[model samples]
Target chain A: MKILVCVSKSPDTTSKIAFTDGNTKFDEAGVQWIINPYDEWYALVRAIELKEKDPATVIHLVTVGLPDCDPIIRKALALGGDEAIRVNTDSSDSYYIAAQIAEVAKKGAYDLIFTGKETIDYNGSSIGGMVAELVDAPYVSLATLFELNGTTASITREIEGGEEVCEVSLPVVVSCQKGISEQRIPNMRGIMAARTKPLQVVEPASIETLTSIVNYELPPAKAGVKLVSPDNVAELVRLLHEEAKAI
Target chain B: MSVLIFVDQTEGHIKKASFEALTYGAKVADQLGTTAEALVLGTVNDDLAALGKYGVKKVHQVANETLNHVDTQLYAKVIAEAVTASGANVVVFSHNQTGKAVSARVAARLKAGIVAGASSLPDTSNGFVVRKPVFSGKAYANVSINSPIKVISLNPNSYKTVAGEGTAEVVALNVAVDASKIKITAVNKVVGEVPLTEADIVVSGGRGLKGPENWGVLLDLAKELHAATACSRPVGDAHWRPHHEHVGQTGVQVAPNLYIALGISGAIQHLAGVNRSKVIVVINKDPEAPFFKAADYGIVGDLFEVVPKLTEEIRKMKASA
Candidate 1:
């Protein structure tokens, strides 16, 4: 089995969000960049698990970003991937990123494609579907468990109120979320092996983006909590009715 | 110009997000001085024309066995064709899994400006700018669609589904659909009394409920309210609830009408998921719980005491009604 796992560089989840340049762009200053947690924790680990199950299987790491992202790509290689491919360009937009990934998948003819349900940064959850569309394949998001047999893959996902089991043919796209697998850390041996793995760089495919980010801003500061006397339970109800009007 | 809404369905029935999209599309159609129409793919046994109660004037069905399952590429192609055939300037989607998949594909195919996770109707007073949650529900961004054909994917539960009086005219479209690229091997459903996404009311518990054994109170309240049950990430990680029921930054993002949180401190990640809920009620013993800051109503008491009382009161009211 050949599995392609998509990863991206995003600001760490704990980064203090701030904007610069007249509030038109996110300021990356003093922010720690890390592999998106969803991709790192679920997609990568799941790929490694699949590879572990089949030692001959190839797990390739793909990312759409500048050369600076290579360290994380190499780290992924160290984790378990047999090879890595970096589309050497800043991600243009979701479509552009999907197109670049699709370009690689088309040439490589991967049997299965894996990506995080949504990047922790953009949280668009669109790329997996977009790539599936670009490649004219089936797409499933938030797959909690996935297994492969012959030319088909069986996946179980939570949908609405129930768990939904779905099967899709090979060359399909899946976005991984939590519960897919426990998070894995790269050990010294895995990290050292990643240094020797194949790291290929390719140019991005030509594509036009349908949308662009105008700017980003932080959420409003939450108001301090209102503490009502524990004995004044009725007063709490009165405040909810009168002040909050939420009851 | 008309607005065409894609009504996504599963198991021969309409998805809840589709209704929310229908309502959103209808309101947008009203805003654009046009009527809303629907294009339903696959096989649905429901009354197609009766969807007019949600403000659709006509229902277009393209029932092919191939379409019983969704193929994003094929669906996008057909919808783009429908938008052209119907002369729809505005297209709306539900931004759910289906909507997230197909909307961008349709937009790319048509070169239309696309906005996903739209929380409200466009500000048509000026140019077409739609407000959507950005930074994972932490902020809002108003994006302007410059393309002639504007696509908007409404965030689920962001808009109210208002019922009105009308019947739709069902028209079967003669579009040719290709063979499905995907196959459904098996559908293992986790049967539950309530679906978390479709639930009007959701009751979520966190680690503060102490252990999984103490979750009886939550189940009692959820059962009384006919509400879906959810848990925080920690609780799910601790095996207090199924991982599927975990709703937070790393879990499901839901927007229900009423969200009741018990024994959960409002972490930023958890808040990111449920901030879109219309109403939040927190029941926590801790007076300093951060969730109360965002809650519209909060009860300062132990869940063991408050939840049963609330459930009993609700049950009494239900019995009387």
Candidate 2:
């Protein structure tokens, strides 16, 4: 089996967000980044698990970003990806990014393509479907449970009120979330091995971005908490009912 | 060309977020000088025309019993067909679980540019630009989709739903359901509880509650508020709570109207999941707990005393009223 898993970089959850150039660019001056948890923990880890189950399976990691994304690609490699491909481009447009991935998938004839259910940064979850559409393949998203059997794959996804289980064939694309697999930690040996693994960079195909960021703003600041004495519990109830009106 | 809204339903009743989508679609239609229409895949028990209060002029019902349950591919195919048949230039969906599952597929089938997690209505005044939350609600992105057909999945609770006195025309849409390529073998449901995704208010607990035995304190508070219950990832990882009830970056991301965190030290991942909530109340014994930074209200007291007292107060408020 030939599988391709997509990964991206996201700011560490605790990173304080700030923008530069009059709030037009994300301030990365003192921010720490990590491989998006969904991509690394769920999609890529599940693919690695599949490879572990079958020795003949080959797993490839892919990402579309500027050269700064190399470290994240290396992290995926250390996590058990056999090879890495970086599509050199700005991931500003969902369709454009999906097109680049579709191009790679078409050329490689990968049997399965995986992406995080959505990027933590953009939260779009748009690329996988567009890629599936561009490549004329079936798309299964938000898959929590997956099992591979010969040529058929049983996938379980979360719906509104319940879970829906389905079966599909290979050559399909999936956007996975939690419950697909437990996150794996790369060992010291794997980290050393990743340094030797090959990572190929391909120039991006020119595609137009349908969307652009015109501006960036933060949520309005919340008011200071109304601290009531523990003895004054009645006032707290009154405040919740009349002022907050949350109940 | 009109704006088409997908009114997601369960057991023949429309989901609350779908009403918000209807309002959003209708407002978008008004922006473009077009009409807004809604399409439901299966038969619903509610009076469909009553949805006109949200500004929708018409409701299109597929009336298929088979579609009562969600089939992502099937719904995408059906909605794509409905978009074509209705001459809709824009398709709107609430970016809830249903929208997350199927909207992109519909966008793919139509080759439409989709912007999910939209926080506001489009600015069609300048070629259809929409603003949405990004970076896990830390920043906003103003995206423009220059497509003949546009798909947008509005984030739940982002757009306030307005109801007006109006009536809609109910019409039946005709479409053939394709034989599903994938078969559904079973459906495991979380019954008799408010789903975390759709809850208006959420009351969550953490390891500070001591153990699973003390979960009743949080559950009691949750019941008093008519809110769903959730837990931090540590509580879930330790099996103190079910995984579905877990809310964090690794768990479910929710944006309820009010989120009350009891005994949870606010981690960034947990905040990312619930920060989009309209109002947040944090109760913890530790004044230095990180969750207080993000909370709109904070009570530095033992939850063992605070939780029961709060629940009792709510119960008293209910009795007096």
Candidate 3:
């Protein structure tokens, strides 16, 4: 089985979000970039699980970004992807990223495709569905767990009140979330093997832009805190009813 | 032209979010100078025609036993076909879990431009541009779709469903139902006293409640308000509450009108999920807790002292009302 895992590099969640160019663009200075946690922990780990089940199985990690993304791609390779593909293009809108992935996925003839539920940066879960649409395959999203045997795959996904169990044929796309698999750390052997693994960079296919960010702005700063004495419970209630209007 | 709205139903009952979607679709139809129609799959006990109170002119009933359960792949095919057959240029869905899956697939099948988690009506001012939350709830983005057909998934609790007096014309669609290939193995429901997503007012306790034993005060407050109960990730991880009741970036997303946080520091991850709420109230012992920053109102006092008093006041207010 050939599986493709798509991931991105995003600012570590701890980074204090700031913007430059008069708040027109995100300030990347002094910020550490990490493999998007969702993609690495859930999506990539599950892909590794699939490969473990079949030694001959091949997993291709794909990302669209500058050459700097190669380290993150290599990190995913260490995590258990057999090979890596870097589309030599700075990641743009979700539409363009989906288009790039669809181009590679179509030619590779992957039986299954995997992606994190959403990138920490964009938080757009639209890519997997759009790629499924572009490739004309079934799309299942937010899968909590999945199992594959032969040509069929069964998935468990969380819904509003309960959960749904679904079965789909091969040649499908799934966006994974937590509960799919435990996060894996790369061992010494895997880390050494990843350096020797084949890493290919291909030109990006034509992408039609659909949307652009006009500007980026941080959320309004939180208001100052209020303190009330623990003994003054009635005062707190009064404030809630009159000032907070929350009672 | 017609507008097709996907009615979300479970266990033979339609969800409140679907009603908002139906109302939004009806308004979009009015904007286009067309009639709004509904497409229902499962067995709904409510009077379908009465949905016209929300501006639906017709409700297309597809009472197929196979559709009693939602299969997104199959439902996508059926809804896409319904849009084509009904000659509808616009398709609408509630941006909930089920709607999120099917809307994107239907849009792909129809090759229509799609927007999910829409907060308001289309621009309709000139071309079609829908505003949606981006980067969680921190910001907004406007997407323009020049395609002939448009698909929108409305965010729950974002729009109020306005009622107008009218009766809908019920029309049965004769589309062939395909037996689902997927089988439901087992359903493990959370069995909550109050489902968090559907709750109007939520009272959530965090690590600040100190320990599970002290949780009684929080539950008492929730009960007094007839509100649903929730917890932060740590509280749920500690088994103080069921995992399903955990709300944050990694758990369920909610947008209740009123969200009360007790003994919780507002982490960015937690804020991302509930920031869309209309009003937020934070109660904590420490005045400098981060949650107070995002709170519309904050009280600095020991929750043990303040929560019981607040509950008493609300109970008295309710009794007097």
Candidate 4:
């Protein structure tokens, strides 16, 4: 089985969010980057688990970004990806990125494709379905559990109030979230081997960029909290009802 | 230049978010000086004509049983066809599960630029610029779509739903659908409780609660307030609460009207999921807990004493009112 896992770099969750260039560009200065948690912890890890179950299974990592994304891809490699492909581009548009990934998936002819439910930066939750449409394959979003049997895949996904179980044929695209797999740390051996692994860079497909950021705005800072004595629970309730009008 | 709104339904009932989408779509149509229409895919039990109260001029129903459950490919195909037939330049959706699953595919099929989790209506003064939350609500980005056709999915609870006087003309749309590659086997629905996404008030607990046995106090407060229950990642990881009730970056993200935290030390990740709440109240013994910075109101005291009193006060207040 050949599986293609889509990976992306995201700012560390603890990093303070800011924009520069008249609020038109993200401020990368002093921001730490990491493999997006959903990609590393859930999508890629689940693919690695599938590879572990069957040694013949091959896992390939793919990302659409500039050269700065290499370290994040290497980190994913250390977790168990066999090879990696970088679609050399800087476009963050979801359609452009999905088109690039779909191009790679078409060339590779993989049986299954995986992506993080959404990048923490954009939280669009749109790429997986877009890629599936571009590749003309069935797509599933928010998958929590996945198991492969022969040519069929049984998947479990979270619905509004509960869970839904579904089955699909091979060559399907799935966007993963938590409950799919546990996080894994790369050991010394894997880290050392990742340096020698193949990292291929390909030119991005010619696709029209759809959306552009006009400007960015930070959420307004909170007014200092109104501290109430714990003994005055009624006052807090009254304040909520009167001042905040929240209840 | 028409506006088409996708009305999401499950088990034949329209979702709350769909009403917001309809209202948003109508407002957008008003902004564009066009008419707003709605498209329903499944066999719905609700009154289709009544949806006009939300401002739609027409309701288009497919009346297909197969669409009752989401098949992303089929839904995308049908929606694309509907867009083409109706000559809708702008498509609207509620950024709920169904929208997340299908909107992008429809955009791809139509070669339209799409924005998910749109927070407000478009600014049509110069161009169509829509604002959306980025970095998980830490910031906002105004995105400009240059495509001739555009798709937008509104974030749940972001827009208000207003019902006015009117009845839409219900019409039947006939479109051919192919066999879906995916098949549904079973559904396990959580019953008899407020869904976290739709809750107006949410009461959440965290590691400071200690154990599952101590959850009754938090539940009691939630019950008194008629609020949904949620927990931090640590509490969910430790099995103190069900995974579905976990609200954080990796769990379910919520934006309730009021979020009351009991003993949670708001981590950045946890805040990412819920920072959109209209108001926040934090209660923790540790004065240094990060949650206090984001809270509108805070109490630095033992939750064991604070929670019961708060619940009792709310109950009494309700009784008096």
Q: Which ranking of candidates, highest DockQ first?
A: 4, 2, 3, 1
Q: What is the lDDT of residue B161 in candidate 4?
A: 91
Candidate 1 vs candidate 2: which has greater DockQ?
2
Residue range B196-295, candidate 2, lDDT tens digits: 8889899999989989999998898888888989999999988999877889887888998889999999988898889899888888899999998898
- Name the runs in model 3 displaced over 4 angstroms: A16-31, A66-68, A89-96, A134-138, A148-152, A166-171, A185-192, A206-247
Interface RMSD of each: 3.0, 1.8, 3.0, 1.0
Highest lDDT: give the candidate number: 4
Candidate 2 differs from the real structure by a C-alpha RMSD in angstroms, to one decimal, of 1.8
Query: Candidate 1 lDDT, tens digit per residue, B90-146?
Result: 998888767877887787677677777788798888788887776667666667676
Error of 3 at B320 (Å): 1.5
The 10-residue segment with the lowest total lDDT in model 4 chain A: A90-99
Query: Model 1 segments beyond 4 Å from truth?
Result: A227-247, B124-127, B190-192, B313-321
State the lDDT of candidate 4 residue by residue for B214-258, as single tens digits: 999999998887789999999989988998899999889998889
Each model's DockQ score: 0.40, 0.60, 0.41, 0.83
- Best-fitting candidate, measured by TM-score? 4
Give the lDDT of residue A247 in candidate 2: 72
The digit string of per-residue lDDT tens for model 3 on B1-321 reads 899999998878888899999989999998889999999997778888898899998999888878877776678778988998889998999988778777777776676777777887887786887777766777666666656888888888888888889999998888887766566666655565666786778999999887888989999999987788888988877888766678877667788878999998989888877888767888888877888788877678788888998888788766775
For model 2, state the Cα shift of residue B157 in Å: 1.5
Q: Please, what are the lDDT tens digits per residue for candidate 4 over residues A1-247?
A: 9999999999998898998999999999999999999999999999999999999999999999999999999999999999999999977578888899999999999999999998999999999999999999999899999999999999999888788999999999999998899999999999999999999999988899998989999989999899999989999999999999987
Predicted structure 1: lDDT: 0.81
True lDDT of residue A232, candidate 4: 95
